[model samples]
Target: MDLNWYWYIGLGVLGGGVVGWVINAAVQKARKSSAEVLINKMREEASKEAEHIQREAKVTAKSEILKLREECEHELKERRREQQNVEKRLSQREEALERKNDSLDGKLKNLERQEKEIELLRERLNNRENELQQSISKQIDELERVAQLDRETARQMLLEKLKNEVKNESGLLVRDLLEEAKQKAEKESRRILTYAIQRYASDCTYERTTATIPLPNDEMKGRIIGREGRNIRALEAATGVNILIDDTPEAVVISCFDPVRKEVARQLMERLIGDGRIHPTRIEELAKKIAKEVEDDVYSAGESAVLETGIQGVSPQVIKLLGRLKFRYSFSQNVLQHSLETAYFMGIIAAELGLDEQKAKRIGLFHDIGKAVDHEVEGSHAQIGADILRKHNEAKDVIQAVAAHHGEVEPVSLYDVLINACDTLSASRPGARSETTELYLKRLEQLESIAHDFAGVESCFALQAGREVRVVVTPEKISEGEAQMLAKDICQRIEKEMNYPGQIKVTIIRETRSVEYAK
Candidate 1:
């Protein structure tokens, strides 16, 4: 039994084992299948994940391409807009250039037309000038033919005829006018001068620079010529004069250039002869006394002139100068007397001419006052007189008359004219002044010579102390009218060539003689 049991158990055990193995194998196989299924599932899952990742990548790439295309389109549109703006500006500039060129072409055409018109005007003007010149030339030729003479010959003939006519008519007219003027002036001048001369009658006294003193006797000469001529020398030295004690009959001559000094010496000698004192000291004293007396005499003469002329305003110094004129001499006439005569004549003329007589008298008195000091002063007596008057406060009219009387200054008033006329009339009076025989003959010869210098003059003679010239002309050479003209021409020529005191008459003589002797 045990055995059987053991075997069965063993077999049971083996069977169990075998069954367990088989189940084990089946379980392994099931596990293997599960592992493989898991692996496959995992692979499949991985593959599916990879495919989804690939699709996502493709979608992202497509979106990026679309975005790039859109950006390129926007950039191209901006570039096209910029190109259009550039083309529009270029077209506008071309149109403006074309318009300017058209306007310039029209202006150039107008300027060319104006230039052509100016050229035409110039040509027309030139043609007109040529036509005018030809017309003027034809007119000149016609005039020359009608005159039947050349232009120069016709002009000379007309001038000659006109000259003759003008000379005759003008000569007649001038003669009539001169005759009328001479009639009026001569009547008035003669009346005035005649009345003036009749009013004033002045005495004529000739003044000499030397004096003759009559001595009581000739023996007084030896006393005058003290021992060795000391007395005569002292007298001359004291008096500035020469004392001549000659062998004449009771006479002594005192010589000096100054009339005043000569008078003083004469008086001194006379007094010395009377006093019988002949020394140098006594001679000097007497000279001084005589000089003082001469000075008193000069002042007294000046006072006398002032009183005579009735001019009350002259200074004492001027009066003294006037008194000095009493001893002065001019052309052999006493200056004081000449001045008095001039003053008297001036007064008379002034009365006739309705001028101031007193003023005229004053002018005449002072006119030659310069002659008193002329030896000491230089220059003309008229100018010196005027200066002295000015220093002494004389009137302007008086000074001017004095100065103009000599023509040293221009005369500005009627006083100057009247004074000059009076001076001339006074100086030119007959016997007022004398000339030598030689001068008178020479003047007459000069008059005849002047008349002989003219043409057609046959002979000439000076008559009436050369106051008239008679000219004889050839009758065949000079007509009556020409003779009259010749006389006038000779008169004018004489006036120009000669200087005379008065007017000279010219007489022209023409004659035709019909003389036949029966033989």
Candidate 2:
């Protein structure tokens, strides 16, 4: 039984092994079939994808080729249009050049024709000139033969006649022109001057410088002397002035070159006399006090002048110098008052003439500033005033006006001339100045002598206190025109020879008297 069972088990084991092997073989075959089917499907999908890619590439290449072709066509069109425009512009420029060439040719031909015509005309003129020259020669020969005089003699006679005629004509012309000019200028100037003077008027009052101080008695003079002239010396040293204690009877004369110093000394002497304390120390104290007061008065006067004139920017040094004029005098007229008067006159005249009124007033006020220091400086007052103004940085016009105010320098502008006129007006007004009888008579004589120096003057008289000179001329010797000329000549000589204030009027009187013997 064991054997049968073992044999059956072995057979059964072999059968199972064969069945397992067959199952393995079948499974391998089935897996191989599925894998083959999968590979075929993958191949089919890959081939479809490759065909789609090839179609897309062909379509994209076609579109890109069309775009490139379109762009090339556009660029070619643009190039063709630009070439057409260039050809059109070149043709237009060629036509313009041809037209210009034709015009230039025509102009050149016209110029050639004109040049030829001018040459022909020049030849004709030359022929005519030659014929005229021959005719003139014949006329000259005939004239010399007819007159029975040489050419030179006839020419000289004609020349003399022509010279006489020309002299008369020129004299008449000059006289007419001079009369017309004088009438116009005199009318305008007279109108302006009369208007200016009428606008501003001052009194005929004059101020005189007082240098002598009086005391109560002679004892006051001795007390002022004070112990071997200690007080006088101290007073002089303090005031920088000279004290003249002469036998003038209870009076002392204070002399100083500086007007301000002289004024201070005068005040100190008066104060010392009034105080009755005439000693060295007292004098020193009084001098300082009076000097300070006078200085203040100077500044006040100067400031008042500046304010009255309505001018600005005057330097302090200039104002101080101007104030010194308060104690200054010219021909017994107070200089400060004269300056103010002059300034007013200048302003009025300048306004009438349409000039700078303020500048004119400034020039007038500072015109005579040199007189304040004329004693201390070596020069004319006008020159010194100019120097002072220049040093103080005044305007060039103002300095020039001041310098030329007295005619010391040539006038550079209208202001300079106006200052002279205004200054003369202030000084030469009625009772503005005074002189001794001797000087008055001397001036009159000088005026008469100057008139007599001219020919045809029978008698000359200085009337109006030397302000005017009337000349009587012989009518037979001096004609009407001659009298006018004589008057001018006399005036010129007087102006050149003499120095006097204001202007002098010269009147030439031509009169003829017929003497009859009725008896």
Candidate 3:
């Protein structure tokens, strides 16, 4: 049963195989169609994509072309603008160069014109010089022919006439100049003198020879006289003055011709009397103490004088010497005070005249420095002061001023003249100096005797306290020129004989007046 069934199954299997083959072929065919359809759709899609890609590439190419075109246009526009700026700058340079060229041409033309003008003027001057030379030659020839003398002689005569005329003119001119100079000098002298006197009015105090020291009683004199006049002798020796012990009851007299010594003695005596110890040792001690006090006072006085004069940087030694002058009396006036007053006057006048006030004050203040040491040192105060100033390395102008103040040397600077002016003002002021009756009479007699010895007989009178001497000369005996000559001779005699502080104005008054009186 299984075999027959196998055969039937095999037959069915063969049929089924045939059917299955057909169906399989159909399915395969269907699968092949479906693949072909898919391939076709993919091809169609690819063609569309390729076309879109090509359009997009065309659009990109167009955009690139537009961008390149815009860049090219921008570059062209910038290049055009740069070219315009360059052209405008070149035009400006060209205009500047043209103006410079025009200026140079104008300058050259002006220079040429100036040169031509200078040449024409030179030509004219040369022609004039030639004409002048010709005229001078002709005139010389004519003068030589007219005069019998040679050319040189005629020229000399003509020169003589011209010289004479010129001399007369010059003489007149000189006379006018002399008159003007005299007037100016007089005006200036009066102004300077007036200013100097008015500015310095320092009071004068005379140091008397007899110094008074009031004692408590007469018993103090015995104590002052010490054990055997030993105290008085020691005091006199120490002070360089005379100590007069007398019966004048309550006062002791210190006497000396030298005012400084007298002052020192008086001060020492007063100190000793006040101390009430009158032994020789005590007298010596008091003398030294008083001397030191006097020295300190002198130094203070000197420093005060310098400060009052407004001078600075003076040497201490000079200051000390200046202080010593406070005790010195010259012609009854305090010498140091007088010097300070003179310095003030000089400084004021110097400031007014626009001169060096420091230099003028320095000279005036130091002018009397010699007076401090004059008692110890021998020489003219002016010369001594000059030497001291030189020792201190003073400026030459200052030294010259010191030396020339008293006419010891020729005054070289305005400061020298100013010092002399100050000195004169100080000495010549009223009540500044005094003379004894004997000395005044002697000076007057001497002056009159000297004037009487002159060639022109004249009566002389000492006027203004011997400051001036007026001589009345006989006009009949002395000619006008002789009167001037006689006055000069008398002045010379006075200068040679007398020792005076200032200049004496010499006035020779010669009047020729004819008088007819009807009665």
Candidate 4:
């Protein structure tokens, strides 16, 4: 039993020991596992702290690098600005130097020109000095050789000698030249005038003042007188002509101051007498019809005149105006006939003189065209005719010729002078125009009055039927030259103022004879 108890206790104690050991081992293992877990957690915390520090350092480095790059860029910009400023300063210095160089070049050019001028002035001064020295030397030599004459005496002697020589030679030369010129002029003038006159032998017809009209019967006059002379009165009033219906068998006398009006009245009376309707109303109507017919006749006559003259391209209006010259008269000469004759003569002379025959014929034909309407128009017929020709677009030379035919305008062409010469020859031909008794006496009075107007004339006489005018001049008051001039002046004045058919030969009789006979 005892052995069993001991054994049981030993067994129990050993079991207890084993249990304590197992319990101790389990507690120790648990402590070790908890310690290991704490260590691993601390290691992980340390590694995390190191990683965070590394990240902070890397960020700081990147920040520092960026700051350094920025600072470098700022430095580079500053360096570039300094380089630009240096370049600008250098450019300014270069410009200043260039300006200085240009100024120096201008100054050098001026200096060079001044030097050349100084050299030229020096040369000129030297030349002038040499000329003055030579002149002075010559003057000294002259003074030493001869004595000076008085200025007035020397000049007077020279003048007297020159004057004597000039007077002798010049007087003879002038006299010879004057005599030769006079002879030549006389010969040439005679030739020209003779040729002009010989070439143009125009027919001159005397203008008759009386117009004749044949009546139908003697009883027609009683009808013309009408019941109370109303027909005659109407005829006179319409035509400005007096009806002379007495002592005539088969004719009626028409008298008027105007020849045109007289012819119109004469024609009107004839028409009324032939119609046998001699009343005041019929007279007025016939008068108007006859007036128109006469006007038409005048136009036709003018056209015929122009056609006869071989002048074409004349306007109808100009022809009508020219026809009016048929009834017009100048110095007892029919103006239209005279113009035609003058045109014929002018054409002949123009052919002889180697001129334009058509132009000459036209100018001569229209020369007196204005005379037809001169009473109604102003100015001379030549000037008026020129206006008409110009309006018709005539040649410039023709217009000039027409205007200068009467010497009223300055002759611009040779044709103008030729026209005047031809006109003069046609009018001044012998027996061309007749002078009336009243006109003859008036011309004689005019001659006497013109002669009296002269300074040396004592008396004047118009002889040869006013063809010659003799002026008796006082010998004591007039010299030969003065007498010649007086005669020319009288002739010119008579030509200008008087309407004569032929030229008047002016004779100045200056008598200086003394009647002292020794027996």
TM-score: which is higher, 2 or 3?
A: 2
Query: Mind sharing the TM-score for model 2?
Result: 0.68
Which portions of model 4 miss their true places by more than 4 Å? 1-204, 211-222, 233-262, 280-296, 458-460, 472-477, 492-497, 514-519
Q: 105-128, model 3: which lDDT tens digit per residue?
A: 999999999999999999999999
Off by over 4 Å in 2: 1-176, 514-519
Clashing pairs in 1: none
Alpha carbon lDDT at 46, candidate 4: 100
Please give the CA lDDT of all the candidate structures: 0.85, 0.89, 0.81, 0.81
Model 1 weakest lDDT span, ten residues long:
201-210
What is candidate 3's CA lDDT for residue 490? 79
**Residue 369 in model 1: lDDT:** 91
- Per-residue error for 230 in candidate 3, Å, reads 2.4
- State in Å the error of residue 183, model 2: 3.6
Instruction: Compose the digit string of candidate 1's lDDT tens values, residues 1-519.
Output: 678999889999999999999999999999999999999999999999999999998999999999999999998898898888888888898889888889889889988998899899899989999999999888877888997777788789999888867776776776677779989999999998888888876655444554788888888888888899999899889999877766788888887877788778878887888989889999888788879989999999999989988888778999899999988876566788778888998888888888999999999888899998887899999999999998888889998999998666889999998777777777667756666789889999999998898888999999988888899999887665667677788888886778676568998888998999999
- Hey, what RMSD does candidate 3 come out at? 14.9
Candidate 1 off by > 4 Å: 1-171, 203-225, 243-253, 273-276, 442-519
Span of 10 residues, lowest total lDDT, candidate 3: 201-210
Error of 4 at 278 (Å): 1.0
Error of 2 at 114 (Å): 25
- The C-alpha RMSD in Å for every predicted model, in order, reads 28.3, 9.7, 14.9, 21.2
* Best candidate according to TM-score: 2
Q: How badly does each model clash, as a count of residue pairs?
A: 0, 0, 0, 0
| TM per candidate | 0.61, 0.68, 0.60, 0.56
